[model samples]
Target: MTEETNGAAEPKAAAAPSQPVMQVLAQFVRDLSFENIVAQKGITNAAQPDVQVQVNLDAKKRSVENQYEVIMKLKVVSNIKDTQDPMFLMELEYGGIFHIQNVPDEQMHPFLLIECPRMLFPYVRRIVGDVTRDGGFPPLNLETIDFLALYRSELQRRAQAEAAAQTTPAS
Candidate 1:
């Protein structure tokens, strides 16, 4: 047997890359306001008010390196179902500073909008509850939100709006 007959090839070596990293640098309440619109009268009233809540999310890159800020804006309005009188109004803009590294650009948008906010929801919910209770009403414990579903729905809505805008004739 001769060595020339052997067919094995030499293997090449390269450095192992680091995995992706994501961290919550800090979480805080950017803004919060509670209004007892009807004052003492609303609490004394026997009628239970219907509560309406709306949440909006937004994110932006920070001036510092590898850092981004995500804001979860929440609005809550309560009014008597049968009557036009308002009970209370609460608004909160909760925010977080996140440090993201090694994530692909394509995935960054969803990660920031959905994942970041998802991580911060519990704290925001607690604050809302406390604020309502302190304002002399029953605590408004907000339910857990599905950020992924919300993001998808927003995308669909934007697509429909763009399509509608394109179809309408300009005067």
Candidate 2:
């Protein structure tokens, strides 16, 4: 009798499966400040306002097992397009607590920074819109942020800064 046989080495597809788990425990606004500069200064302009937005992210492990906290910081500023008169300024910091499991150690940072904040963005977006509308301006709808790109930019920035620091002579 003849028997067909496959290779002795196990195929990679047959290896152990990896299933990462993530859950958002809680989310809230950590800090917020809004200034209606146009209203305060009694400035009026027909031109549309130019808006600038900045975002930063932070994450830390909690004492509880499989728990972590992630914070998203945003700063938004607006000005009259033609006259450059200040319109408004808003700074907000939103945070979330998460329970994560099964993610490898090497992947934890990206998972925390990217996925957690993505989950929190909608609520933060609503708060910003409400604040802007209530402050007497049109509701501000923020564009979707690409967290992966942001993460890569941060890494490149850090690497560049580290390289520059290494080359600079001590004062």
Candidate 3:
């Protein structure tokens, strides 16, 4: 064998396993509430009027290894029955687990806050519709929300307030 072939070859390094990734994740509403605004009688019995529904979206995150859990909180509210009665409030919180290994740091925040909630909104919408319909009132079909716009508006509002406060003389 001719004095040895090519001196000893170097061993090749093993390739690392591919980490998991969040291919798809979604959210939806899981609870609700409804109440008649004016249910009292004797004086002038009035059917439930002045119905108002307010919507709120919230998000939360938890990390496990390279994965994350994103939760969405959706809430709806309406006026009270007799002013002496409690307000009609419906709240639902849903969540999903997402694998986010190797994702860029900058995009993660928006993914958790805005994108996750956006995914969850449709589910939340259907739940609200069903709950209100089941609650004896017509389904309170909600319009789609623009989370990005809302977020930007909130930031702008805060900035304006801060600027105003700074410019104005303190009492």
Candidate 4:
């Protein structure tokens, strides 16, 4: 109340250092599709059954100021025994959005993209397996995914493609 200690004259306290906030704001399967391309009786009546599966994972970031929406997309295709037609085709794109307002600079990159998806992936994977089982097929047990390895492989693939394109003769 005194003139010597005006409200604005008080020394401000130093801000508390930023700390990581671990959270999954939302998680969901954004897209899912199942296509049985060979429903024809002749194709389904093959003498032997063999299955081939192709799996893929993809990710993208949607940034809005201080927050981000990270998506992990998974695709699977299965070919039935003795037929070229796909017996099952499933694609799922799941995502989580996080409000990481006060996260420190050093940890932000890993937290928003890596850790969030790491937390969300298992749930999504389970859903895929269960859905496949529910659809009257054997559960598709996916192997444990190495995200870092996958990312590296994709980068190498892109690099190789680019190099090949540059070396090819222009026709």
lDDT of 1 at 109: 95
User: What range of 10 consecutive residues in model 1 has the weakest lDDT sum?
Assistant: 38-47
TM-score of each: 0.86, 0.88, 0.59, 0.65
For residue 154, give model 2's deviation from the true position in Å.
Answer: 0.6
List clashing residue pairs in candidate 3: 27-120, 29-124, 37-81
Error of 4 at 86 (Å): 2.3
lDDT of model 2, residue 158 = 98
- Model 3 per-residue lDDT tens digits across residues 11-96: 87897766535644433334443543323322332335344544444444554465566665555665545553433456666665
Model 3 alpha-carbon miss at residue 18, Å:
12
RMSD versus native structure for model 2: 4.2
RMSD to native, candidate 3: 7.2
Judged by whole-model lDDT over C-alpha atoms, candidate 4 comes out at 0.66
Winner by TM-score between candidate 4 and candidate 2: 2
Judged by lDDT relative to the true structure, which candidate is superior, 2 or 3? 2
lDDT of model 2 at position 58 = 97
Model 4, 1-171: lDDT tens digits are 655645577677998776766556677777887654444333452334344434344434455566677777777776655545567677778777766667777756556555666777788778878977775567767666666666567668989999999999999
Find the candidate with the highest lDDT and give its number: 2
- Give the local distance difference test score of model 1: 0.90
